[model samples]
Target chain A: MTKKTKWFANGYLTLVFVLLYVPIFYLIMYSFSTGKTMSHYQGFTWAHYVALFQDARMIQIALDTLLLALLSALIATAIGSLGALGIYATKKRQTRNALLSLNNILMVSPDVIIGASFLIFFTFLGIGLGFGSVLMSHIAFEIPIVVLMVLPRLQEMSTTMIDAAEDLGASSWQVLSRVILPAIIPGILAGYFMAFTYSLDDFAVTFFVTGNGFETLSIEIYARARQGIDLEVNALSGILFVFALLLVVGYYLLTQYTAKRQKAGVKRP
Target chain B: MKRKQVLFEMPYFFWLAFFVIAPILLIAYQSFFNIRGQFTLGNYATYFTSATYLRMTLNSVWYAFLITLFTLLISYPTAYFLHYTKHKQLWLLLIILPTWINLLLKAYAFIGIFSQDGSVNQFLTFIGIGPQQILFTDASFLFVATYIQIPFMILPIFNAIEDLQPSYINASRDLGANNWQTFTRIIFPMTMSGVKAGVQAVFIPSLSLFMLTRLIGGNRVITLGTAIEEHFLVTMNWGMGSTIGVVLIIAMFIIMSLTGEHKKKGRKHND
Candidate 1:
């Protein structure tokens, strides 16, 4: 906690950051290394990025990934937020425990098992595994994660705001829209981002649920990876890395800002 | 929101039932059938009797244990750095951005860097040391596993450390507690749940991971996931695949239950 120690902490933090990013930096550098060898930096070129753009299937797969991620996030967020509200509204102890336990199963269980199970489940029920089924399977696993993320904020929400609105002749619907919605918006947004990231990098469940002739970006990456480090895929991955970084950075800032504001309020009072 | 919400969700539930639920149930049912299609534990017996299957299960368990252990070791210092630093806002972006890279890509990147004439070897040769073929070895498999699981360990521990009240640590130190004493007695105990949660988060996924083995382990390291993939995808042996998958699930459930019980006991003792 001294000045010297704080400076030491600076060095420590920098080292941690380097360890985290060196692998990624290595990837980006070698991605443009102008070699079919996939290693050994021969020279520099932008051919990989160009090749990535020209591959017609890359656009389709990108669209598939976005559509799947967005649809899954929307459904999972709805189920999770509503379920959290229901828990808030009812406040039944046994119901709460049961819901939480179920949520944990959905959240923490092995993705491979869940994916495998769903694959078999669909085949047994004669459901055709396709892009649509992939989205649904994504939701089954994701809704619980959303609930876990959002429920704590809902529980902490003050009832006074809702009652205050109702006391002024506002309907229940009006109270929900005018009071509840605004309060939970940040938490809901956080849940949405979590769902989006989870769905974006997802493979296990997607592997199980994805059917004949349908490929998302991750699955396509898997097929390419089997052959070797194709530089074009590296460029594509770099782009995804940037996008996910933005979402995570946004989530971290919003959460920290809220926490800091709360601490400031506590100090004042 | 409503327009898209209802259009997407109504049929989606039905879609989940057929795709997600039914396949899981079918896998469960397959574990009980015989060649005659009569109900029995025949599949389970066949799987258990095969020594190769037993060894594969053990391999999966041991490999996952190593990944979780090593991931925690690497992540602890990183998580500790995040905990004590003020620049956590930017530092976390560095830590988490790599996690977004496709797992396969990371595995491939390792191959790119560690292959016989790869980057690491070339760099080593630039120094005094001779070249070593570290790729496709057990060490590489361990590296790949740890790399994938580190984020899981880091996030849970970091969250716990963030939520930690500074007052308790300060109070303990004020009472003449040394650095080690304060950390072990106060900090570690409080973060025990986070550590446990971290273990579960990393352990479960690492336990079931087969794809990394496939891509990077190069057909040498066989985990339960690889076995299941083979049974289901390669041989079309649904019955055997379900049996293996079921056993893996049961083992995971037991491990999770034990962790849950330990945490409850810890909380009770604290109370």
Candidate 2:
């Protein structure tokens, strides 16, 4: 607000940012170092990065992680969006509220609880633990988030549009594909991305549900980290860091573009 | 349309009933039974009667509370500061960006920071102080926990403060309110919802922090989360693990109730 206060704020903000970024900077620096220990900086080398990419196990795990995220996110988004639509379509307020509260169980429950329950349930079902269990677990937790994301968007949409589409003799399927889907596409996309990221970042849930030679990146990182970390892990993390940054930037740009288009459309109309 | 809606919801409803509801029900079921399939309250009895288990739960709540408290204290001012800054969006983005990075990576990075002969101790040594042990201590654990939580706490508070109309502050000023008075009477009360939301976000996750308890705390700090992990993974005791899981669910609900999130929703409906 004032000059002195402005300077003070800048100083405080800088310190906070430094605290946030310095550890990450340290990790990135060590990833390139030829040394194994995190403490020292040795001759610069790309050996860690090379090893990270070249390792068959790491490559497989990375692919598995991506595949799991994609599949789980897709399944969750589909079911969740439909669930949102159905919940919205319900005429009775009581049923809608009941369904929402049911959804909140998955949303609020700790991952450990979810993970443990899933683990026991799968064990009980004699499914054991592997890709299927992990994927199911991801979808189970992810659905609620997707529903929450899409529900608000659906609620904001004017019901008159749907009514008009039906009145115009459009089939239910046609109205869904052409009208409802198009109107809530952004929410669906948002839900998908959120679900995907949650799947990718998840550890505890995956940890509990994964066994019998299955591994995701987080699980692998946890295992390796417990044995004391190697620089290859740092290399993997650096690459993932860059990937996440790019994703965030892309999302930001996409939102900005949509906002601009919306504003332009409003002005034109 | 209603029939079509039901058709669409059928698969999801089955999934929720089986995967979402059934698993929690399974936990509740397992918690009541022992390994021999005999119905018993042994799990709950063990949790409530054992001093060690009770202490672990207390530690979980205590550490989680401190983490939330420290995060709020740090983030509130930061959010308030960012609310006035010109590049508020950019600053907010910067704050939130790290959360995109995996929690494990961030925790791993802090390992380097608090390690012996690491940057922190190295800096202390540079300042003519002895190299201090920062790793595996309560302080390091709390520090890392708070670090991970800051962004989550900041965003909500920032949004809440930003949402406040400047006219309200001006009106308070016009009525002869000083900055402190205005902040106390208007700003703090209005932004409390955000604070509660932030606390909920940070506090809930901090409760079940398993990996960090091992990596950062070095097995020194044992929480209910780590205990659950131990019961399920190490001991192969599903009943005990399920019991702990059930307790955590109840605790989660209690926290939700304390935050008054459901009550707020009801108030909004009434409005």
Candidate 3:
């Protein structure tokens, strides 16, 4: 809190931030380098970016990865929100605790265990390891997080509103759609965003479930990285970094807006 | 309303059974069979009896401990200091943003930075140490793993620090405790839960960072994850993979119990 301590604190934080961001910027910086390797400082060129744009397989895989993230996050959000509601509605504390523990299994298990077990499960069920398996695995892993995110919001909601809706002759469906859904929308949105990021960033689970022909961006990056540095992959990373920045900024703005609106609502009352 | 709620919850229950419970059960069952599809306990037998498997498990646990320890060391102070900074939320967001970038990319970045002529080596050479092998070493692997896990450790600790009541600190000061004494006696104990949570988050994943073992460790550092990947994907030995998978699960449960939250029944006064 003193001047010297404040300076020390600022310096330490600056060091940590530098350590965190250097790798990312280093990766992106090389994408524009004409050199094939990251060792030397070659002059800047747009060749890697141009190459990235032209790589049909990479572009296809990128689009597929995006599609997979969107679809899995959507499905997971729906199922997980319902699961939270169900758990909330349960009358028995033992059943509720049981449900909560069951929900956390996926969240706690290491990726290798989840991936290996899911692979065995799919093989036993005769489901091919490809897009379907990958999507299913993503959704499976994502559901728990969605439930975690939404359950707190559900707990925070007052029961009086639902009772009033029921007393005013609103049907169950109408009460859910008109009252509960609107109230819990922020949590649902947060869950969806978290799920989307998880799906997008997942490598280990996707690596196990993906068959020979299918690949996500993470898998692709892993493969190319093992083969040593590929500037094209670097180019793709640069673009993805920017895309991720945009997504984070957008999410931050959304959360800020909702928070402000909630404050205003409270003030008005 | 109850019927409708059940109708909506059907998919969730189905997911719980099929994906969550069933996969675990299936993996445990699959551990009994060999690659030939014959029923046997040979997989577990091999894992238990083989010296290689035992050593690998030990090494895996050792590396994970180191990673967790180093991550905790760096993150605790970072989180503690970060709590006192202005615009702390924004700073926290900056810490989290790096995590959103694909982890593989971050690892790949290290592959470049630690390479023969990479930045670190370049720096070393400039200082006349003249470019030694920086990549594919245990130190490099540990460094990168800790770097990746730092944010995770910081977040929970930061939250815990935020939750600490200011009155307690003031009370401790009023009772004539110095800063170090106050921190050691009060601040650290209260934030123990966050440290436990951070350890759980970092340690489990560190055990299975197979890709990091490959990409950065140059396949020199083999963890349980690397072994699982090799068995399931490379060797096509599903039985062995499942066996290792089961061991990993048990290890996870052991850790969970060790760090498991004990209900704060009543506040204890140290005075």
**Best-fitting candidate, scored by TM-score:** 3
Residue-wise C-alpha lDDT for candidate 1, range A195-225, written one tens digit per residue: 8878888887788778877888878888888
Candidate 3, which segments miss by more than 4 Å at Cα? B263-271
Q: Give the lDDT of residue A73 in candidate 3.
A: 100
lDDT of 1 at B231: 74
lDDT of each: 0.77, 0.89, 0.93
Model 2 chain B: weakest 10-residue lDDT segment is: B259-268
lDDT of 1 by residue, B1-271 (tens): 3354444334434434544456556778887866455788888988889898899889889998999899888787678778777667576666777787777677777777788888789888989697897877878899878987787788888988888899999999899999899989998888877888889888888877778888778878888888877777677676777888888778878878866776678667997
TM for every model, in the order presented, reads 0.89, 0.97, 0.98
Q: Give model 1's docking category.
A: acceptable
Candidate 3 versus truth, CA RMSD in Å, comes to 2.0
Top candidate (lDDT): 3
- A1-269: candidate 2 lDDT, tens digit per residue: 78998898888888888888887888999999988878878989999999988899899999999999999999999999989988888779889889998988887777888889888889898997899999999999999999998998889878898899999999999988988887788788889989999999999999998996899999988888888868998999889989998888887887787668667856995
Question: Which parts of model 2 are misplaced by more than 4 Å?
Answer: B261-271
Top candidate by DockQ: 3
Residue pairs in candidate 1 whose N, alpha carbon or C atoms collide under 3 angstroms: A120-B23, A121-B22, A121-B23, A121-B24, A122-B23
Evaluation by TM-score, superior candidate among 1 and 3: 3
Question: lDDT by residue for model 3 over B143-175, one digit each (tens)?
Answer: 999999999999999999999999999999999
For every model in order, the TM-score on chain A comes to: 0.88, 0.95, 0.98
Q: Ranking by TM-score, best first? A: 3, 2, 1
